[model samples]
Target: MTKHHITLAGAAAIAIAVAAPVALAQDATVAKRVDKLEKEMRAVQRQVFPGGAPAFFEGEIAPDATPGQVVKSNSPVADLTARVDALESQLRALTGQTEQNAFQLRELEKQFAAYKAEMDKRVPPAAAGEPAATPASLPVVAAPRPAAPTPAPAATATPPKKPATPPAASAGKPDAARLALVKKVEIPSSGNEQQDAYDYGFRLWSAKLYPEAQAQLKTVVAKWPKSSQASYAQNLLGRAYLDDGKPSLAAVAFYNNYKDRPDGPRAPHSLMYMGIALDKLGRKADACKAFRELDEVYGTKAPQDVRTDAAAAKAKAGC
Candidate 1:
């Protein structure tokens, strides 16, 4: 009997384990459906507004739209804006309607009051402690409507008021001069002997001269290896190789840069690309760990866009 009881309990446990995956699969399907709906909403918004511009410019509109399409789309979007201005004028006129309605209601109450007064005159006054005539006992006619609000005068087209004079402390400071100085403060060109080399490497990288850029970039790393720009140059070199379709070489470049300067501004991006290179190599597990490191250390500290990109990659890789 004990053996049978144990067997029954084990079967129940097996059933629960089987049910768990089924429930999770259903939830995942529901989540995917929600994602699909959100995508549809975005597609509809794009169809209505077309581009990335704001709601107002959404109708900046294509010249080639068919007459029917234009007519169909002739929304109150612009008129609504004009109506916002018209609302002020309408507010002034609103009191007129209220007054007109109140006057009509007041006339109605007065007529009813006069009729009551005439009927009461036809009946005798009742003695104290005695019941009064039914009509005499009736309540007084309705209260009179309150007086109308005075119409506001139209706003005059007053000349634009002069801008107020700024206070002394603020006026004494020349912010424009300060900004001009800041804008002109170019990093010293002749200050460092290797500046030309660094600048040339940057130009080459921008031009997509990967191998030549790497060669020029190496000049800076070899000459001024301890400088801050060395990390930037190394970051660019890894990018160059990645763009050149050399993932392994790119990984080597990024890994070396991170090893040398793990706390760099570019380090997170470098590590991210290293993971990409590993992904290209089909080393997914290692790639996942590398991505995990980015989340653990710098998720909050990193830029939002970078964090978003990293999270998306992690999700796509199912890590």
Candidate 2:
């Protein structure tokens, strides 16, 4: 015989002998596992599908069954359950690992999509019903609003010796002094923010920057018509006009202010100032009406000093 053939025979003999015992042991283990699975399955089956009543022997010639009939009827429910349970356990162990691996793969895909999004600034946002993002896409920024309007003056009036009054509000290139005043004079906070506007307005008025202050305060009243300070700002704006030698603008301010906030705390002042400003504009009927409104609204509450001063103006204006 050839040396290769002899070697081949030796290896084959060893492999068969070793494989035989191992195979037998594996079969025995499988059988034992199957039996154990059967017992557990039968216990569960009894709880779920217990058959009806048992028969027993009566003492005196009764027609009933004796013990050991469980085997005679070929009741194989426990055996069937055990066989099914053993197969299911093997199936679950094998398939459960594969299912877990699939879940991990899906989670990794999600992480990759998020990582791609963070790096791309130009990518559009995800839309409703849209597919998930991939590495090729990025993010985007939103558009901004139009530029804010040029700030108006705090008060409304013309400059000294200026016959024509310039537009108080400008678009792109606004007046420097007016803008400066607007930035410096923020509308104050209050229950009646209009009144806060007016009070700050008064501080501006006392400073003698009447036109700018009037415009700013007037804006507060215009923006918040319901504000308690609406009338105050309006009336003060009228006064600012009169001080600036513009009776027409003053009349407009006072009239607008009074009409908007009739019961305002500054109503009396508004009415009185409108009468004075209108009287200066040679509008007598308009002036008298304003004076009468002042008298009617502020009967007792009108300060004696204010009434006296208004009375003097009315007499001077022939209202």
Q: Compared with the true structure, what per-residue lDDT tens digits does model 2 show for residues 43-88? A: 4344334542232211222222321111122335345445555575
Q: Report the lDDT tens digits of candidate 1 across residue range 50-106.
A: 686553222222232221111112345334334433543454465466568679989
- lDDT of all predictions: 0.51, 0.52
Q: How well does candidate 1 match the true structure in TM-score terms? A: 0.39
CA RMSD of all predictions:
43.1, 30.3
Q: Each candidate's TM vs. the true structure?
A: 0.39, 0.40
Assess the local accuracy of residue 155 in candidate 2 as a C-alpha lDDT between 0 and 100. Answer: 35
| Stretches of candidate 1 exceeding 4 Å from the true structure | 1-191
The deviation in Å at residue 271 for candidate 2 is: 1.1
Q: Which stretches of candidate 2 lie over 4 Å from their true place?
A: 1-196
Candidate 1 lDDT at 223 equals 66
Worst 10 residues of 1 by lDDT: 127-136
